[model samples]
Target chain A: MRIEAVALRYRYPRAASEALRGASVGAASGSSLAILGPNGCGKSTLLGALIGNIAPSSGRVLLGGRDLATLAPRAAARLVAFLPQFERMSFALSALEYALLGRAPRLGAFAQPAKADEDAAYRALEGAGAADLAGRRVNELSGGELQLVRIARCLAQDTPAIVMDEPTSMLDPAHARMVADAVRALAASGRTLVFSTHDAAFAAYAADEVSLMRGGSDQFRGPVAEALEAGRLASCFGVPFGAASAPSAFFR
Target chain B: MPRSPDDLRARSGKVLLLALAGLALLAFCLLAGRYPRPGLLDPRLLSSDATARAIVLGSRLPRLAAALLLGAVMAAAGNAFQMVFGNPLVEPGFLGVSQGAALGAALALVAGARSEFVVAGSAFGFALAALAAAALLARAFPFGGWVLRLVLAGFAVSAFMSAGLALVKYAADPLRELPDIVYWTMGSLSGASWRRLGFAAIPALGSTAFLVAYRWRVTALSADEAVVRSLGARPALSRALVLAIASAGVAAAVAMAGAVSWIGLVVPHAARLMFGADARRSMPASIALGAYFAALCDTIARAAFPGELPLGAVTAVIGSAAFVALLARGKVPVAR
Candidate 1:
């Protein structure tokens, strides 16, 4: 499914300024879009708008040419999957069990997941390259292992598009490379993918296109190579950038 | 790691074993009473001895059924409560359901209402009202997350209900009403009759069925709020619905048993220990195990000595010890 945020504007409850001021971005199916920005650049807010979690004060989000606000939650979820930056698990659930939760939108209110749902969860684990972790308790997994399992959960959702907030943040380079590989694989699977990241090198390696943001507005949107140019990076982040300091880019 | 198929098979087998064990315990409880010489009554006695038949059919059967229902409902509801609130310490009565029921029963008694139906009915009504008040109070609080606000609201509601109960006790006539109120607080199943069991069974059993049928949804609610929403569930709406259903079942059980303790607070923990924490397995396990624990405890409460003991006291003594043992064994996976 193609998703588009057409000039979204939003404000927090007691805040003096809008968090999202006419920020817009879009991603077509079978492509990946990386949102790059400095701190407080409204990337997360824009992602929230795309997923229909936060209502925009004005403008709108569109999913495949249909107004996102018109769809019910289940219908919307069926069209798009989402992964937040952080999630807390209250109990010790096996990886397979946690992934099975993604089948919820397809089941009835009182229905249990059938064999097909279990198969989907297993396939999702394999897709995320964490199939070996299926029976392990999610609470006991290391950070990178947990992130892969979480990505597997998003895959188990089986939606046409997936959105993630900071999918590779807070990880060492090795773990970050693993997540970047997962992202590349997901993009290769012909699904619409959107993710936010502060690592320009990682973004350039994994994303087909990049959307740069500063002060709650899109400053630039183009092919990753053009968006990552030193002048553009310096302007977007309000810092000097030398081509030599662009950092070690992860493998494609 | 074992595959998903093996995990499913193992969990199912464990649940089936628990159900069978529960059935065996029920049979033993039915036969082991003070009547027929303080031990397991020979199964052949029902055909030959008339007094044994009356004791088994007239008294023990209904009481045993009430105890089983009380256990199953409280344990299942307790599991739901813990999952929905995202707090391991939460039990069915944490939201003032027990205190509200106690206050309702005390007020009915002080109002000169003598019938068991009237007293239990009053309790049932107040228990639901207490849940509503807590929810409303939680919504009204501007600070804290949903779980924190609800917990705080429950604490305040319970304190107020306790104060109300104390005032009711102070105003009662010391001799006639005081002892009855005191006895009610300790909880007992001696009043289990066929009619009373029928009255409490409908709501309690219905609620338990819903929780078991919707077990995975309960597990989903146990995740972070943002995760639940991303999964296409309205966390606030779903949480409210689960809490209401679980609280209603708990209120019904409390009305029937008069503030039975420990079963609701501890049985779910045991179920999670025996089975994994997935509600798919632990929920049914909790129901079966709860019935067994309650029946076994009640059998001891009624048959261990000359005079009947309070069911609440017996369960507290046993449940606490089991909790300690579980802790000593380690691997609880409880979030502190």
Candidate 2:
């Protein structure tokens, strides 16, 4: 499915200023795009709009040439799967049980998961490299492991598009790379992948294309090489880009 | 390594054995009561004796049914509320719906509505009103998360209801209505009848079915609200619907069983302890465990003395002791 945003704008109910303003971008089917921005630049807001969590006050989000707001919830879920930046498992669901929640959109209103749903959960866990952790309680998993399990849950949705808000923000460097690789594999399998990240180097390695967000709008959008240039990076962040090198620990 | 078929069979046998033990406990509950003879097969009680039939059908049977239904309804409601709130500690009582019902009953008594219909109607009306108050509070304070607002509203409503109940007590006739209100508030199944059971069965069974069916979606609620919305569930709408259904179930059960306590709070935890916390398994387990516990408690209430004890008193005593023991064991996390 192709998702397009046109002149999108949004504001929190009581906030003094708008969170997003006049932002526009489009994601082609089966492509990987990374949103890069400093904190408070509306990256999460943009992701929220794309996933239809928050309505755009002034513009429209189009999914497959149809208005997102007009689509039914189950139909929207069947098309796009989203992973939020952070999640807390309130119940003591086992890893596999948690992953099976991804199949919710496919089941009948009152029906439990069938064998096929279970198989999908298992496969998604294996795909996300979290198969071994499936039997353990989710609360017992480390941060990185839990992140992978959540990704597995998203994968189990079998949606055409996946949007994640800072999937690797809380992980260690090694686990971040592993998550990045998993996203890359998902893109390679002919699924559209859109993710937001602050880590520039990780975005460089993972993104097929990059979009820079600043002041609640898209500043630049192109191949990573052009978007991640020293001049653009410095301007976006308002810092001298090479004075303090990108953390070497991230690259290692 | 793969388990052999023989090993799997042995495990299944152990499970069957435990199930049989549970059944034995249920049988004991059915047989033990205030009557002089306490055997299930005792022909003396079933020999067309009017008093015996009155004891069996009028008192014992209805009480047992009330206990089982109350347990099942409370446990199911508790599970749903806890899941929707994303807190295991939440229950129908914690949300102050029970207190609201109690206040409704007390107010009806003071107003001279002595009929059963008036009592059940007032109880349900105030229960829904309490829930509406919680919903309004949540909307009014959108800055606080949904759970926080709900919990705060519950406390507020509960305090108001308690004060109202106390006022009713003060206004009541000391020799007549006051004692009746006090006995009712403490809770009992002595008033159970087939008609009362039929009236309550609708909401109780209906809500239990809804909870069991929607058990899978409850897991999605653990994610962020945005994520839950993206996953085809309107988090706010679904939560409100579940709360209404679950609270209505509690109201019905309370109306029938006269404010039975502890089942809603403790039964879900017991189910979680026995079965892993998958709502699919936990919902059924909660129902079964609740029925079992309620039956056991009712049996003790009936048999512990020559006359029946208040069901709520018995449950509170047993539930508090069990809760303390569970905490002292230090197996489950104390705080989430």
Candidate 3:
């Protein structure tokens, strides 16, 4: 499936400036796309818009050539699975129970998860390497482990497209690499993967294409190599360009 | 990794023990009252003696049934409220729906509408008003989150209703209406009849059924909205619908039983302790445990003294002690 945004704009309530202004991008089928942006540059807002969590003030979002706003919640869910950056839970649900929630869209109204749903959830957990933690309470999981379980929940939805906002923002280097590898494997399995990241190394390793956002607008969109160029990276982050030190800062 | 036969037997025995305990409590509820009745083992008196039959089936049985139904409804509603709000501290009364019902009932009584229908009508109206206020606040302040908005709206509406109730009490004829209002506010099952039982039973059972059916989905509300939505559920709409149903059930029970406190707040916590917070298990366990607790409390209230004490008084005394004990034992964590 493909998703396209045209001239998108969004402003949070009571905020002085719009979070997103005329941002546009597209995700090709069965590919990985990374969104890179400085703090407060609308990366999260863009992810929200793509998943219909936030309504754009202007323009339209298209999924598989159909307008996103016109699609029913169930239909939209079947096509797109979204994992937000961080979610704090009030209840202490087991990790398996939390992951099984991903099968909700597939079940009928008022239906509990069947054997097939359980199978899907198990596969998702396995895919995200969270199978061993299934019985543990979500609150007990480490930051990286929780992110994997959250992704497993998205995987359980069995959607063709997955969108995540900084999926590895809180992970250590080893776990970050694991997450990046998982994203690459998901993209390889004919699923469209779209994620936002601040770590350039993860983006270099996983993203087929990269889109840079600055001041709530798309600064550039191109192949990973082109987008990661020293000059382009400096412009996107509003920092001094230094090619020699940039790669090591992310890689190490 | 296979379970041993003894372990399996022990598990089965534990289940049986719980079932027997539930049945014994129910039987004790039926037998303990102002008038003596034949024991559960002897069924002959129910068929032979008129007063025995009247006391057992007409009054005590219906009262027992109402207690059980209301208990289950309140507990289930409390569980739903806590889950949807993503706050374990929440209960059915958090959104002022109970107070709204109370305000409506008080207004009806003050206006001399003493019929059951009038009381229920006022209750339903004010319950809806409370729900609408919470929903509107949620929409108006999108950033405050549903729980925050609901709590704020509840506090405001509850304060308003409390003041209104005070006004009605002051304006009432102290000799006549004041006693009636005061008695109703304290809550009782003394007026329990088949009709009253029917009023509380239908809605209470209906709401419980709805919550049980959606128990799994309700658990998902603790996750991020985008994830829940991707799973084919509309988190906001589901939360609102569940809240409304749960509130309606509580309102119905309040209309019948007159603001019986503690069950809606405490029973869910008790169930969580025993059942480990899986709504599938917790919901049913809550229903059974709540019924047991309420019936047992009512039995104590009726038989503890020469005259029946108010149901609310009994519940408050017992509930506060249990809550404190649970806290002291570190069974229930302090709210963060």
Quick one: best TM-score, which candidate? 1
Ranking by lDDT: 1, 2, 3
Q: Estimate each model's TM-score.
A: 0.96, 0.93, 0.92
The residue ranges of model 2 lying beyond 4 angstroms of the native Cα positions read: A243-252, B1-19, B37-54, B330-336
Between candidates 1 and 3, the one scoring higher on lDDT is 1
Docking class of 2: medium
Best by DockQ: 1
Interface root-mean-square deviation, each candidate: 1.9, 2.7, 2.7
* Model 1 Cα interface RMS deviation (Å): 1.9
Tell me the alpha-carbon RMSD of every candidate.
1.9, 2.7, 3.1
Model 3, range A1-252, lDDT digits (tens) per residue? 898888899999889999999999888888999999888899889988898888899989999899998988888888899988878766667777788888877877778887778778878999999888887877778888888888898999898899999988888877787788889899999898999987677798889999999988899999999998988888888887564543332342
- Name the lDDT value of residue A7 in candidate 1: 89
Please give, for residues A181-237, the per-residue lDDT of candidate 2 as tens digits.
988899888888899998888888888889999989999999988999989998998
A67: Cα error in model 1, Å: 0.9
- Tens digits of lDDT, candidate 1, A70-160: 9998888888889999887778888999998988889889998988999999899999989999988998998889998999999999998
Which of the two, 1 or 2, has more TM-score? Answer: 1
Candidate 2 positional error at B13, Å: 5.9
